[model samples]
Target chain A: MQFGIFSVSDITRDPVSGETPSEAERIDAIVQIAEKAEEVGLDVFAIGEHHNPPFFSSSPTTLLSHIAAKTKKLTVSTATTLITTNDPVRIAEEYAMLQHLAKGRMDLMLGRGNTAPVYPWFGADIRQSLPLALENYNLLHRLWREDVVDWEGKFRTPLQGFTSTPRPLDDLPPFVWHGSIRTPEIAEQAAYYGDGFFANNIFWPKEHYMRLIKFYRQRYAHYGHGTEKQAIVGLGGQAYIAKRSQDALNEFRPYFNEAPVYGHGPRMEDFMEQTPLSVGSPQEVIDKTLTFREHFGDYQRQMFLMDHAGLPLKTVLNQLDLLGEEVVPVLRKEIEARQDPETAKPPTHAKRLKDKYGDGPARQPKPNANRGDNVTGGSPYQDSE
Target chain B: MGQNFQLVVVSAGTSDPSSTRLLADRVAGRVTTLAGKKAQTVGTSVVELRELASEIANALVSNHIGPKLQKAIATLQRADAIVASTPVYKAGASGLFTSFFQILDNDLLIAKPVVLAATAGTARHALVVDDQMRGLFAYLRTVVVPTSLFASTEDWQDNGLNKRIDRAALELVALMTSGFEKSVRDESWGSYQHEYGSAGGTELSIDLDSDLMKLAAGGSAGQKSAG
Candidate 1:
């Protein structure tokens, strides 16, 4: 299993100190955290995308590209790139460009953004969220795979002979994982496309995601992509660790009580018992994480939410250190030993490139010079001569 | 031909000997007797919100139903008909009553028969059943019986209360024996929209051939541009 951390990019006030970091400070701190994750041997560092206030990561590709440039081994990605509101054409081009800059050290998880008003802000309707997501993704899929695309959809203007430039690095689109908290249609979409399905397993009970993941796996096999065991799956979790369990809980309680999303709600102890929020020692985190395999079956990736709720940058770095040193090493061994031999590994840039074009030159589109209009040409790019 | 029916009674009373529970049981008992005349055996199950107050509150905060609440929801979903009773407080329905229904899947009670009842300390709150409860159940799309039962302090001594209770029970029985709820749900299931992420609750089946799914596969001919 690949282990990593994902941040919601909340600029929360430190409850204990009553000091909130400035936007610039928080942004720099996240970049530092990403670099530290690589130094500690973590596999991935994903950031969330939010367009509203108190959230710094409205643009995930820019941040991910910067992180990728700084780290060689650690994969940079988005916790969720909003597929509902973003134009699929822009997503195709921007991510393809990022792939070239990162040299294929990137992939993305797509979600219908949680904020409702964001839809209207982007000139979309929340009532048509599912249709928007489904349609946009269909267009995005074609943009990446096909050299030149002719497409029209209900949500966007028509694209005739539109070639999304920078045509993905080495002719391989970044592997996509659809992330959802509760929607089954999303799971069905992921399964139908033979893509990965990621469940935000932190806020809800295990039974909730167990049903979604099980449905995705069954449908993956039903769609003739692979056996149920071979379907790719990922889960998001939350944890806070210290030497003693009490210390961890005591330290995190103040932040837990005041943080948004779940603050002033369920108590920390009850939340931990009810959801996947683990607050304890390194061993406790290990024990809690291992139960995930039993609950959701053998999965490919496991990401944790460690940097949100106004925790300081130093504390988040410490949590990463414990994860890389104590938790992931043991988890990697234990989970791998129990993994079914038929189960597929998580997709990477190299693996996808090899799968698409084995021992052959990858496709490179050369645009025909200055055709005033693309409508007159049979093809937008020149293949030979 | 004799058939079995599931009747669930939800009582949102805070006291141990609350008039709300009394009213619910009275409705359930009368409905069973009236349905028996039509060769239908009614099996009754009661959900006392007073007993599940903490679990309901926790579910509100955590957005997850506990085991006891899940069991109550399951019991309600299996019910062929329902008798929903609540005690009015501060000129409105009890918070416990509204909270329980808020957590329910929107499609759970679609086209199901329901008898709305409310108990208040005074006769002035009589319209709580029609004014408030009917609107709530209407939003859920339940086929609430036209006759609603309201019990006041003096209603216990009035013969009119018994007449209204019997009338409501008769309406519920008539609706149940006709199997109108099941037929409507089966025939017009596609017309009702479901809340997202309700796959585990009332919405167990999905239409794979929906227009959205077709578009996801690939858009229609109009969606393909001419090159």
Candidate 2:
């Protein structure tokens, strides 16, 4: 399994220190964290997008591109890109551009954003989130494959002879993983398209995601993509590591009691027992993560939420060191040994490009220079002339 | 076809010998006797929220039911009929009673026959059964019998309480004998939405031919209009 860390990019007061990092400081710290992940031999660095206050990652492509430019080996991705609010046309172009810049060291997980008010701000309706996500992703899927697209949908204005520019790097569209907490329709959508389904396995009980992942896998096989075992899956997790289990618990308790999303709710001990939030030594974290395969079956990717809840940058870095040096290496070996040969590996840029075109040149669409009205439809360019 | 009926009693009483549990047991006994008169066998189970207080509270915060709560929820789901009794506190139903239902899957009780009963300290809060509990079960879409039983301190000594209980039991048995639960579970279960991790709850399946799915697949307005 590919192991990495995903951050929601929240700026909160350190519950212990009572000092909150400025937005600039948090943004800069994320870059440093991503670089450290690579240095410690982690495989991926994904970030969440939020448009409201306390969350700074409104622009993921910019952040990911900067990280990609700085690192060569570590894959940069989004924990979730808002497929509901963002125009599919823009997603097609921006991600395609990022693919070229990062040399295909990127992929994205699509989700309907959690914040409701963001819908009205983006000129969309919250009630239509699932439909918007489906339609937008359908359009986005077509944009990357088809050179000229004639499309009409309920949410956006109709498109005729539209070509999303900066066609995907090497003409291979980035692999997409649909992330969902509760919606089964999203799972169906992912299975219908033969894409990956990622369950944010933190926060809720394992039974909740087990059903979703099982449904996705069964549907994936039903859709004739592959056998159930070959369907790609990803899971989210959270951990805090120290030399001793007590030290891990004692240090994380304060942060856990005051963190957003789960603070003031379940006690830290109960939450750990109930959910996938692991607070303990490196061995303890490993033992907990290994159980994921038993719970959801053999999966392709595993991402941990280590940097949120106002944990300091240094502490997060220290946690990452333990993860990379002590945890992931063992997990990689143990998981690979148990993985069935029939199971699919996580998708990457090179593999996708080769799958699309074996020993042949990839597509490079040469647009016919500006033909004012694409509707009139005469080879909008000089080449056709 | 006649089959054994599953009756689940949910009592939200805190005291050792709570009037709420007494009311629930009485209603359950009457229902079993009434159904037996109709030559139908009824199997009964009880979920005492007083015993599951901590588990319910933990479930409320953790969003996942413990083993005991899960068993209780499962028992309720398997029930052909339910007798739900709660004590009225301060002109409202007990918080524990409300919280238990809140944690339950809204669709779990859909179309299942329920006999709503509540016990209160005075006759003034007698309307709690209909006013509050009825509304709550209505939101759950349960087929609550019209004759709700309310037991006050004086109700125990009055003959009207037995009459009301018998009337409610008769309605519940009639609904149960009609096999409403079987029809819902077998024939039209797909029509209902189910919460994730709910007992016997399946994934939300979509009708591919529906307008919403068509629109999601990028079908145009004209095509929708044509259909």
DockQ of 2: 0.33
Give the share of true interchain contacts found in each model.
0.29, 0.25
* Candidate 2 structure quality by residue, lDDT tens digits, A94-193: 9999998999999999989868899999998898888888888888999987767888766788888787878788778898999987776788778888
Q: Write down the TM-score of every candidate.
A: 0.92, 0.92
lDDT of 1 by residue, A1-385 (tens): 6889999999999998888999999999999999998998889889999999899999999999999999998888898999988999999999999999999999999999867899999999888898889889988998998877887667688887777887888778888999987676788889989999999897776777887899899989998999999899999999998989899999999999887877776667877887888999999999999999899989988999999989999999998888889889999988888888998877887777777888787877776787776352556568733
Per-prediction backbone clash count: 0, 1
Deviation in Å, model 2, residue A154 alpha carbon: 1.2
> Candidate 1 chain B: minimum summed lDDT over ten consecutive residues — where?
B218-227
Model 2, which residues run further than 4 Å from truth?
Answer: A364-385, B1-3, B58-62, B193-227
lDDT by residue for model 1 (B1-227), tens: 99999999999988888899999999999998998888889999999998888778867876756667878988987889999999999989999999999878878888889999999999999998889989889988899999999999999999998999999999999998888988987799778887444623646565668776566555542343544
lDDT of 2 by residue, B1-227 (tens): 44689999999999978899999999999988998888888999999999888778877875656667778887887889999999988899999999999988878888999999998889999788887888899998899998999999999999999999999999999999997877877898777766445443533554567655454434432321222
Provide the DockQ value for model 1.
0.33
